[model samples]
Target: MGAPVIGAALELLRSPRATAALTTTGAGLVAIAFTLQQVIGWPGYLAALIVLTLLLVASLIARRDEIDWHWAILPISLLAYLGWAGLSLLWSEYQRVTLISFSYLVLVTFVGVFIGLSRDTIQVIRSFGDVLRAVLLVSLVLEVLSGIIFDAPLAVLNIHGELAEGGPISGLVSTRNQLGLLAAIAVVTFAIEWRTRSVTRYVAIPSLALAAGTIAFTRSPVVGMVTVVLLLAGAALYGIRRLPEERRQFAQYAILAALALFAVLAWVFRAPIIALFNATGELEFRLKLWQRVLDFVPVHWLEGWGWIGIWNSASPPYSGLTPTGGRPHDSALNAVVDLWLQVGAVGVFLFLAVVGLAFVRSWLLAGRRRSVVHTWPALVLVALITVSVAESSILTEFGWLLFVICAVKASAELSWRSALSPRPERPEPLPHE
Candidate 1:
């Protein structure tokens, strides 16, 4: 009886016209809602998790046609080692804690690959961005309303200088830094779309404004935001310098537009914007954190205490949140530290090789001047790598989807016509021989 309901529900979700983009965005919203529910002391997060998990399962089953050999192999290889490390050290004091931490990584990696590589992933991501943009816009509007209708608390957005500390206006996201990172990536996505003229300048302009709005609400977006701009600008400059004389004008115009856009962003968020530059404490903390991580190398030079030991060893058992015996300050750096700590030299080598190959491929593909055909996904992949430095997106659903799409796009480019063409009939070859 219970099984029938589950089957019907899955069927409905997996239907052809169901739209994975909507499904993806729904998952994000549910996750956000879940986080907020926790802050508000509600039990909604569990429900949201259940719903999103079911949706993901249904979406996969419906879109089973998209699966490939590499999709399963890569993530499985990474997680298997992580699992083995965790299980091997289960007798240790940190066993339970280590399992939790490894679970987080496994979830992120699996979803990241799935979403990053799916056939319509780019489209799904674009849709997800649109929904996120709308949510941010509404939040901004509410901030204005709350300011006018209510008072000081909602009016003045508190900018938490530290990435670890997080900001005040973050809606449902667990960290202010994570929310800010998302906003920054949203801007990068729109910036690329706008530069390519796939989306109207009107849409892109407001999207930038929305990004600025999100940044104003959360101060830490600047680091990721600035890095994204510089990277894209550098790529554009490289592209333009290599362009023929005729195409140079368009590049020139694009350069000018980028300048104008940044000028506007800087002007609008001038106060909080400058604060990002002024925060010495935050900068000092990151420096100290990195140094501490380096110090651990001599001690845990070989196989680490195990997968979860870094956090479990801490007093409160929360990595950055606890501020005790945790591995590192940043999520991205934590991955690096964990790799070195848990798997030793071999794991580190494998990790670097995988990331390096993906990046090199994305760079070569994105840098192509002849076609818009290949450059879009390549550019997105490049952005993913850059953003991965600040956030663990590459280890999550978003990263997986981005990687998968690029892989599929590349595979699609193969010359099928040659393979499909009928072979010429053999005539008197046997007789001649």
Candidate 2:
């Protein structure tokens, strides 16, 4: 059965239509896997991983030319720093966590490659949209059913704190923050697709609404959602300006309509939002954690205590020894804190450098006055990079998938550029004809 499915995938990949559909579904499976984690356990994760591996193999087989050098380069440099830090045993606990971080990102890189191979940026985005849509749809339906089954108007779930018996479920499969991060990405995807008249976006609309509602229910998604919406609106404005005059007016109308709809939904659901705000508890907890990280950094100033070493001790006040206690919730901040806690200032610098370099390179590529190939995908990748900051998305299947999509998409853009560029004239053949 697996072999036949694999054969069919290869065959479909040969055609643009099938390829487009497959790409969309494939990219989306990442989110689906994550969302269902609550229901599926290890087996689901294994299935997802297997699918990811197949996609990676297919991406390699579908190679138009050589793989992009940058894709390999960025991961390698980052990996080297991680390896060096790991071997040195800088911060014991930090080293342990770094291994998991490394593994997570490796997966994300593989997924990114598949995405990079997509025919266009729209295909990549749509594929991702499909994945998030699927995850959210399933979750929303279940949440509704759960509300009905349990005989409660307001079901509640605990998030990152002590559980209150018989609380709202928050519709989060597992972690409260993850649902928020996923919803944030969904909002961006929905906004983009709704404007373009994609039918799936319409189907996914309720899911997006439910996701926002769930966020309000959980109360952890505000910062991420706010950031994503602001970015989406800005991107929409940029996109509208790029369209032709006749289409530009329509695009503007669509954007305004979508924004209004979102506003109305938020207003209608204001109670849930207010509840979320209340549920979020004190900032003092995170602030206390951040202060500990800051203090740890000056003490370990150089190479760091090593990953394993971090777990061995705590940063004075907050009791940092436990990974579960006062953990850095923000991914970017986590990286910095992790580095300081384990490897030191140098490690933090290198990690940031790698991330910054990748973005800078992608930005430069996007700015070039090339045709459809490089320009749009670069823009989309920049958006993904922006999303990665707050969300620990770098370690998820979604992250891997995005990386693969961008890699192939970027390379394909360059290829299309060369193919479409005007060639020198062939003089004599015309006269002879």
Candidate 3:
């Protein structure tokens, strides 16, 4: 490019609105890749992601000195996970899959780090909200065309909803559950944006409504459950925040104590709890899948079968998985169990630490007096944790990307170098004023 062209590009990036637009566009593309992979097709989604990452990288380099470089770095846990995944290729029974998975991890890491480092917490939320807005809007329009006008599914977007026909609308996303997750995040993000008055009422209200509609129409037990849990958790946080400082300190410990007690109680009554749920036949089928996995875990207890979601037939436990389907045992029906089964105990610790640290930092930030914007991180962590226990979404596309973004944002917030790039100082008011 010529000097004038280069100068024009640099000039364009100097405007905050321009920068935000670019950032939000990048975010939308990533959201599409992570949640609507089947719709755009994986290869297309991957291509868009790579291009976005490169553009973000260029922008980062252009404003290198303006950013707090130390806080701009990747999280240690992410580095550890990447390193472990890369190294797993050595002993991995399925070399090809591991290599490809490692590459995908690299792409996701690049995108996550870019978003986290380039923007502040509020901007991160705004950009992410913009992505969800674009997604939900496009998906809704397409669904209307398909389900209502044409009386057929949106084949290109892979949207099949129960709204007009039977179940929840998949929309641009792959499944009803994923759609519900997107909608759930949209609700949280739009609600926070509204509370802060950061976004206009017109945009925020409709987005929130659309998201809520998904929860209702999808009839996804998980999404409904998430909504309830989030509501109660938010209420609890608000109640705790209103408490006196000394009382709040004691309350925190009490909550922890309560959790510890509950753990023990649940363990003691585990058999009955299992039996109680088994009457519904939900736990029975899931447990059978888990049993199939746990049965062969001893084969690679320490090293694990390597860090790929898909297992090759040659791999021991995967080979032993019955019914002759490659999709067998993809999820242990639990994120922790899935992580352990894929990369062993060490991987679980590293991944969980990443999430735990993020949650802790976010919770602390949200605890500040009248810090409404800070709630974004905490609310997101709530969704991530709620999904982690019941599904392996945290290990998959949007879930993984969202988790990484939260972790990176949390790490940035608590970083020691926050003073390095302090906001531009405001001028003092006139003495008469």
Candidate 4:
């Protein structure tokens, strides 16, 4: 009786509805990690992660026989990147920290892999859409309560409640930039949800408005830039998707050329553009910090000091790099630079290959696939890559999770191994509840 009960429990956990719920819950928790840490503290956060990790493992075990197994084949670029990060433990100056940090990275990666393996592309989008809608709603409610109802800060959650002031509300994400990033991603997700007819207009319109309002209030220059890029990317994708197959190749080349030209023009007028966005002060500060970070690069230009995903102000080298009289910088504030600092130049190459390949594959799919849902991964990658210019969020936490999911999903579609092997018939996507 006991054995049968245990078997039934596993079977239930592996059911489609159960997997969708678990995936959404995991996404929401990781998305609001800063809030969780602030509200429940690190001990609670760690406990939540452990519990979620255990559930994920059990779900995977229960579905093992049903899984294609071949779907587990990851891209070489992704494997190389992970291998390099793990190998850093051998020479990492801070081995213990590296081990712990790498473990955390693996933990999140496992969740991403589970979701990618368990769900189809549309299901993944639906999972994100459902969680993000709730997250944005709650964030707006808190902002209104703190900014208007009470006119006070939610210090515990780091919400400044600045909605009444017409700017810079952190919501539950802790920082304006972070909140803006989430809002920007929300906008993409909501737009796709509307286009796919996944949600009724009644739900989709309000969600879009909520995301736009959040982005506006956050007043983040980084997100402002990302929003512009997203618009252009969406437009480009729309055009490409409408083109004939033969013309699409040419259109892609034209778009690439235009982007290259735009980059050059942007750099030439960067100062004026920075002033327009009122980000001059922010740019100056980042410049100074980046110069300081680069100064240490030569010491370990090849292998890096070690892989500590988030900087530890208490640790060596990092301790020395803290800004004078300012709070310790949690990250290098740039993903490429962070990669160079933590894992070295070789690591940067591998990191780029992972994202670069994923983006290319996703982009091509978006152009060629008939469904609008294919565009989500490509657009999300655009946001991630754009934000990475000024934020190192992509190296850890929610950013890493999203990255892994997109990479895995894209890989599953275009993987050379899959092409070489006898492909199994894919399971029908579970009906959306």
Candidate 5:
């Protein structure tokens, strides 16, 4: 390109407004791309991903000097996991499937890393807050049009979504469970924005109310329970921080002990709980699925089938009940199982280390700062981990995108350069505007 054109492009990329707009737009596009594909076709979805990747890369190039690349080594876990996933192409049942999926995942991963490389934690929170605000609102409008206004759900890509018992709503995503999960995440994001005073109460309160309303409409029991638990945990975090510095460690240990005990109790009484929620039959089906997966792991104990290709019905195990379990598999319904099945047991271990370290690092940062904005990264990681229990939230789509952002940001904060030249102590009640 000519100098004049190149200079114009650089100028646009370097603008602060452009940075903010790109972050917001990229997040919005990723979240809505699946729905758009369902509506229009695959082209729109691919176009959105391409545009998002281009914008993020251009923005990263514009700010190359400011970012501390030496510290980039801290996120090696993430890169390593992706590298292994990509390497699976060598032995995959179908190279084309793995190549396409791995390429897309790699692009999304870079977009997330660049997002963190360009902006600090608070800036990311603000960008996501803005993006999610619009998402929840749009979902609400769509749900009303489909279930209440038109009384006809939009079915695309073989996804059935609409009103269920209790007049539950699914909105644009076309699944009550997914809608419920998204709305709960919105509630968390909005709550953080409110606590941090990043947005005015007039805006935050109503947005939160809308999100809560949508969650109720979806009536996803698992989502509802998880939200309640997360809220309690957030409150506990605040309470723990209120202790004297010397007593804080003791308080944390006590809290962990209590949580462990509670978990054990829940596990022992799981049968009753499932029954209470009218989910025992569903639990039985999932148990069978889990058994089948366990039975097949020994076949490819170490290297796995292929990171991305194994999920397709065209692949061996999943293809018409060819042996390694039965057909009609749509997701392990668990992130751990999904990874274990695709990339093997070692892949699962690496995945845990990467994400686990990120969450712990972010949690430490949040405790030190005790700022609402800082707390968001840790909480976002928590949401990802919790939701992964029943959904492949941390492995694909927007969930995976958010996971990369959190992992990269937290890793950046723990870098050697960061320790040597720490960010200035945050001002009390840091200004958001």
Candidate 6:
């Protein structure tokens, strides 16, 4: 009886519908984390995450035989970073907070690993599209109710109900910039869905329009810059996909060189560029905050203060770093700076390795794969990385979840282990539009 019951449970976990349901739920929760925290508070939010993580772990164990163990090495940098974070507990200024925060990070990472290992790239994209569509639709409806219908702010959710005034609205997320980032990612997912014909035109078109509307209303300069970068990246991938295999390698190198030169030129003309984005005020605020963070970094320059993923208001250094009226700042507003403050220089190097390798692998896969779906991960990474320069979103919650999924997926395909062993057979390519 026990054996039969256990077998049934395992069978249920292996079902495709079960995988999709879990993926969508996980993505939705992470994406609207701030909303969840505000609505249900920390206890409820943590409960939901814990439940989701347990279920995903069960699913992963049930399908353990299906995963290629060699691919474990593919996420070596990520593992190293996490390991270093865990070790920081020994030296953590606030050991209790570090333990709690690090646990939250692990829970989110497990969900990402499960999705990456279980779903194909197209399936992952579909799951994200479905979740984002629902989130954005609900956000818009709430904005309407608050701005036009009730004409009052939703104080609990931090939504100012400014949609009626052509928002700098926060929506259901924490800030206008966050909403804009999610909307930008939604745009990429919706476009890929349309190109792949994964969804009908009726669905895809409306989804794209909704995402675009959200981005326009948010009025976030950081997101605006990210959107431009995403467009350029999409165009570059589109062009590279058309090149012959032999010339593609050369083209890739040439493009990299051009991008490096462009980065230097952009830095040289950063004053005008800052004005162009209308982000002069935003840049000034970040520069001041970053300077404060840097000043404190030398105290623990090598190992950092500790691995508290999100800032704790009661903590010593984080509490006093920046003044925001009564509100506590959660991040340094720069991912690299955040890393330097939390995990120090070594953590920063490991993190760069993780993102750098993930982007290169996904970018190459985008160029070589025939199906349009392959481009999704690369474009999404472009958005995430660009936004990271101005926001530390990638270090926690939704941003971290998406980064892990992309990095794991890319590593599964392009890991060096593939060359050492027989390359695992992949699913048939979707028909190119």
**lDDT of model 3 at residue 110?**
70
- Considering TM-score, which of the candidate structures 5 and 6 is the better prediction for this target? 6
lDDT of 1 by residue, 33-74 (tens): 424454544345444444555666667776566454333334
Error of 1 at 275 (Å): 16
What's the CA error at residue 138 for candidate 1, in Å?
Answer: 4.6
* lDDT of the structure predicted as candidate 1: 0.51
Q: Pick the candidate with the highest TM-score.
A: 6
- Top model by lDDT, which number? 6
Q: Write the per-residue lDDT of candidate 6 for residues 95-118, one digit (tens) a residue.
A: 999999999999999889888888
- Residue 360 Cα positional deviation in candidate 5, in Å, after optimal superposition: 1.1
Each candidate structure's TM-score, on Cα atoms with residue i matched to residue i, is: 0.64, 0.61, 0.85, 0.93, 0.89, 0.95
Model 6 misplaced regions, further than 4 Å: 1-3, 68-74, 278-280, 322-328, 431-433
| Model 2 residue 321 distance off true place after TM-score fit, in angstroms | 4.3
Worst ten-residue run, lDDT, model 6? 424-433
lDDT against the true structure, per candidate, is 0.51, 0.51, 0.70, 0.85, 0.73, 0.87
**Clashing pairs counted in every model:** 14, 52, 3, 0, 0, 0
Error of 6 at 424 (Å): 4.6
* Residue-level lDDT tens digits of model 5 in 331-354: 676788878878897889899989
lDDT of 4 at 343: 94
TM-score of candidate 2 to 2 decimals = 0.61
Q: Which pairs of residues clash in candidate 3, taking residues 3 or more apart in a chain or in different chains?
A: 161-169, 162-166, 162-167
> Which candidate, 1 or 6, would have the higher TM-score against the true structure?
6
Tens-place lDDT per residue, model 2, 85-185, is: 65654344444455644454455555565555434455555566677776666655555555555444322332222222332344443545556556665
lDDT tens digits, residues 1-433, model 4? 9999999989999799999999998898898888898889877987898899999999989999977777766779988998899999998989999998898888888889888888888888889998888877888889899999999989888777788988688777777788888888889888887877788999999999999988998887888889999999999999999999989878876776787698799889988976776544777677777888998899999999889998887777888777668533688789988899889999999999999889888888788777787888999999999999888988898889899999998898777676678686555443342
